[model samples]
Target: MKSNQFKIVIDDTREILKWISHISKWFFPLILAKNIIQATLPYIHILFGYLILDGIIAKDSSSDIMKNLYWMIGLNLGLGLLHSFLTRLLNVKTEYIHHATKAEIARKAQTLDYEELEKKESLDLLRRAEEGINSNGGIPSFCNTIGSLITHAITIVYSILLLSGLFIAAPKENATVLERVFNSPLPTLLFFILFASALFLNFKISEQLNKRSYAFFEENVDTNRILNYFGGVSNNYNFGKDIRIYGMADMIQEEMNQKNDAIITMMRSLGITYGRYSALIEIVNQFVIFSVYIFVGIKAILGLVSIGSILKYVGALIRFIGAVSSITIFYTQLDLQRQYLNNYSLFLNLENKKYQGTLPIEKRDDNEYELEFRNVSFRYPNSPDTVLDRISFKLKVGNKMAIVGRNGAGKTTFIKLLCRLYDPTEGEILLNGINIKKYDYKEYLQIFSVVFQDFKLFSFDIGQNVAASIDVNEEKVWKALEQSGISERVKKMDRGIYTNIYQNEENGIEISGGEAQKIAISRALYRDAPIVILDEPTSALDPMAEYEIYARFDHMVSQKTSIYISHRMSSCRFCDHILVFDKGRIAQVGNHTTLMKDEKGLYHTLWTKQAKYYN
Candidate 1:
């Protein structure tokens, strides 16, 4: 990792620790205890092995040997049982931490400012953050780094202390390793040298193999993307129709095969090259083990060292090497997990561009809300041209306005600004004579109940979907459904108000497009805010159906301010006033009859064209 990346990783590590601590106060101590026990088990077993070997080799009495044998059996059985218990407890702890961290991530994503969430870069950041937190051992990119460090440090220190006895020459004399190698027939110094050289070479080879494998996977990520998207279309229910009707099976399969072949070739190249080095490392390890055993056996044969000494020395050497190796590998794994932690941290730490307002919108029983857009001009972030330029409008209680425009004419942009999804880049919006930004964001949002062109309905019970809450007002839900003209349809369902709107055969409930639209409209009605917006919610309905929806919607918005966006002139006729837009500018604004009579106006031109199309 680069310096900046490493900094991010460290920052993330601190944050992760904090989050884990917040979720479970005992989690860190628990992990540390478990790891300590795990690390000590091997040394304890090794000590028991030496005891057993010494008791037998010394030709001790039968009772002594039997006691040693019982100890060996008890050590192994007890350690195994202890390990199993710790593992189960750790798994539960990890699972609990993961759940808590995931919930935090979810809350962060949902509560992010609307404009930030809409930006592509922001969305990508959020996605990477989500992946980092959702990955294996992934709670805020969970890595047992601190625990591993503690465990390995203890193991290394203990193993080194044990091995210190063997490295010293016999007769307890001051010794250089060279003197020991000359004194011993086994060439002890050369054995050390060979082991050191083998370990160094093995480390290099292992590092290269890991690097190669990482590069291979990273290179193929985009290839997998193409394969998953187009290749797996058949598996995705949403794309099943295209696969069947467009005869896309063969094309998708062929593309998938080609992508897979490329990925497989990369995999093969990595395995072939890295496998040789891995095999070499294993061979070297085995050679070291074999040499150690032979030397120890020769020493025992010469009666230079007892059977117990042989077991102790060899076991200590094995433990030392393994601990050292684990320490080295632990650093690498820690770095990788740290990078993932970096992404998660970056996402959570992202600052909102727009500062949150502190002022509160005064509560009024009569719902006296006024929205005024004064010289508002907005261009999306990183865009050259303004989507809504120099737009100004005013709306008060008991007003219904229709916004008419062709595609890309800023009809939706106006709605977005009105709803404060994105603030105007150049001017302020006034709410009841004060800048909307001055009022509390949450309080301001409560004033409007909007159903956008691309509205979403939940796969929940009818009442829940309409009320946007599980604890629904049954009578209110039915009234809203009636206003949206979907009550009778819902009444016929198996569960009535509690019926699932979208589900499979188990639930056996699915609604048509028009029916879904009505449900969305019902959602707006249930909110019953002072300002209402229906941005082409009836687009899927026929002209007569659209008119009926408009008629019902007008009745529903009785005393509330309303904004209706539609391309169909028939829907515009239902509004008290119509605002015609062309290329982000308002071309005309008037009642329907006046606009239609003015033949030279943009509204007249659009109205004529739409009426002709409908006819």
Candidate 2:
């Protein structure tokens, strides 16, 4: 298990690298060339200043001095123009590549399976990916690091060349200046040690900060889960009234406040620690710079070297040190970014149990088909107890059956098995005497149109909501709306089919629960699927509205096989056959009239309890 998890992390990092490589292949060469030019230009400018100083100090006597002065002037002008153009080009190219990479990441995220995405661990990994790898500044920082590292490497090489040249140019008698500088050794060793210590401290501090940031992002997922649950409860009319009456609002507020305080406190402590380390690093950095300057200045004034040479050497050393420091920082950032990319890769690599086949069962229609469950049993992932146990049933094509069950009686789980949202753990589900696993998953999904108890309402126009896409016809949408009993209400609206139906935005209208259910039915009806499953479709509707919808539904799907699940005994009266479930077993199976007459039946008992309401 651990090894598999590690492989997933590796795969994610590889995917991130592939994205980086694609962007780099187009713009990296340009960025590299630009950095090379930029790095070399600074050295050229230093050399030009040295030449100009030499000419002025020598009273411009030699003819060579005049020629060198003109060369320096041309060099300065060309370098400035080249540097400016490259900088602008790189800036624009980086932005374009960054945007393209981010879009690819988002597209990949969207294509991931919904079931896998619902897992808490998967969500946490995705959060890390979004925050660490896909944030506004991350890709740009990555590209910049790559460019800076390459440029700094070239600058270090050039600095070494310049230093070597200085050593050879000095007269033999003046070699003592070089000896004193190199022999003392304490300053050079001290400077490097201090610089390395500061770099190490900065890297460690940044690592801690990244960890805290990741933790904060993970906490947000829990916070969002809590908020969504509260929002759902508060918006539910039945729950809302009681919640208010019991004064539970304060408890919800207190929970939210406590979570917010915890996050804020963690961030505050991280900030203080980061500040302290940064301050200490800076103080040490200043001392290192002061030591270098004091040693170099005394030698130049004692006539050991020319003032021009001192300026060139000091400037080159500073640039070299800066380049090395930047290179170190860039690699540290890369390591941090890679860590998050690994998390994303791990999420993307998880095995989706529902999609483990080459094809879903619904695709093959080689023979006259009947659906069968042979000794089927199932338990949810990571759960010990079975939700469905040793269940077996068969439904021939065109059979209209209703499943009746009390709460937690496994009626929904049976439907989910039929749809292959999950596979049976102990036995086979067969279509036309062949295992459903042999068929294509997508084609299998196409066979059934399911209206779940808790259906979604998209924040799109009515037409898009019903069709699940924008290409649906207005006429068909209106027909579906009417069939679902919402057309009259929709037609009265200002925009009819075109009106946005979410209250969160301007110019959008809020839809009632019953209206939302009608839209859901329309969506299912529009699919024109042969197998229709409705789970508590009338749960939110009044008797008249429910009767009206059932009438239209029966008319529109007269020839299609339908499965209606409801606790309301009156709703299933017209169903051709009813299968009542009790504690994960089939307690009774018969037509509604036959089941109502059976005195020992669970369905008969439920019917008696609910019949009083109608009477």
Candidate 3:
């Protein structure tokens, strides 16, 4: 087994390489060229300055100096224009990468198995990934991290080599203050070591500061989770009426203020800690710059180099010091960025258990299919209690089944297993006399059209919403809407079946509760799958609308095997079989007449209590 530390290390390494490949493929070569040109510009500027100075100081005609000055001005102007153009290209590249990377992550969330969404660990990883590079501190962004690393590293190395050549003495000269130190190779080496060491220390300290800044988000995830939930509730249109009538606005704001206080405290602490890194860097820069100036001044006094050379050496040394510091700091930032990448990579690698099957659900004229749950048991991830214990049942071809149960009696869990949203913890589910896992996960899903209690409607055209595709058949869409009893309302709209289902403009359609429920039913009908499951699809409708559906339930379901779940026991009279669930077990299974006769059974007791109001 791999250790936790080892696993984290591997995840970070893989993520870095993956991002590098993506960024480099688009802009690495161009960025490298830009860096190379930018790197040479400083040295060229220094050289031109020295040549102009030498010409001016040589006691020659002023024409020579004028020519050198003109050349220097031309070089500076050309370099400025080039830098501006390259900077714009860099912006365009980084922005494109940012958008593309975010879209890729969103796509991954959409494709992930539904079961993974329930896991806390998966959700936490997803949040950290969303916080993304550089949002909290120095975390690297995928689009620009590689380019930055390459540019900084190249600049530092080339500056070091260029600065080394300046150390070689010209000749012996008249005695001057501190001339011995400038001529001594050992002193120069000592100063170089001190400058490099101080710069490294600053970088090391900054990286830790950056890591702590981002750590606040992960540490307070639970608090932020509640903050986000209540915050969203305040903005939700569905909760607007409740917020006003119940006077919940002030209450939610107080809760948000409490969470905001925690965020403020964390940021304050991080800021105080980061202040120390800045102080240390400030001290290092002062010492390094002062030392370089004194050494260069001594060389000039000793007549080892001209006045022009002195200016060149001092300017180059100052810039060289900055380049070295920047490179070291860039590396430290990359290290911190890798941790965020590890979080993203772990989420991307989360287990996916779909589509292990080779077989397809066969096409049949009569849509003949059979399903059986063989001693199936299930418990949610990280839960100890079984949600559905040893559940066994069968739905033969063309047989309608009704599941009756109180809340938390495992009705939804049973449907989830049948649809393979999750697999049973023990035993198996079989379709067509074989284990259901042997069939293509998507193909198996195609066998059923389930209208869940919490169905959602999108703001799309009526036909696309019903058909689940943009390339929809208008004829079938109308036929399905007609069967669901919503055709008349849809036909009266300005665009008929092509009308938008939600308000966008003056003529856009806005549906009532019953109309929306019927549209949901239309969506199920348009799928035309082999099996139909309706989990209280008509709960939102009026009694008359509900009666209209019950009256045409046979025509709506047609020959397809149907499963209906409802609190109203009267609905069970329409089905061939009723399965009564109590305390995660099937307490009884029979027709309504047979179950109602047994006074001791859970269903009979429930039926008697509910039947009182109607009687």
Give the Cα lDDT of each candidate.
0.77, 0.73, 0.76
Off by over 4 Å in 1: 1-14, 23-29, 61-71, 93-102, 134-151, 172-233, 294-302, 504-508, 612-615
Model 2 pairs whose backbones collide: 12-345, 359-439, 359-440, 359-441, 360-439, 360-440, 360-441
Ranking by lDDT: 1, 3, 2
Model 3 reaches what TM-score against the true structure? Answer: 0.91
Instruction: Report the number of clashing residue pairs per model.
Output: 0, 7, 0
Pitting candidate 1 against candidate 3, the one with the higher lDDT is 1
How far out, in Å, is residue 477 in model 2? 2.2
Candidate 1 contains a number of clashing pairs equal to 0
> Global lDDT for candidate 3?
0.76
TM-score, cand. 2: 0.82
Q: Write the per-residue lDDT of candidate 2 for residues 75-187, one digit (tens) a residue.
A: 76887788788778868877786676567556656766555565666676766555555542566665566677778898889877765544343344545655556435554
Best by lDDT: 1
lDDT of 3 by residue, 1-615 (tens): 336744664467556567645644646555666666677677767877877787678875788877877877787788768877877886787676667657756777877887886677778778767665435332225324545556656666655665675677445667454665566687668876987687778767766775785577567767777887898898777689999999989999999999889888987888888787778887888788898887778677777778887777787788778777776665555556666665665666777766569898888897778899999999999999999999998888778888999999998888888989898999999998899999988888898898888888888888889998989998999999999988988878888878887665445677877788888989999998889888888888754556568658766675889998877665676888999988788989999889888999888888888775444
| Each prediction's RMSD to truth | 3.6, 5.0, 3.4
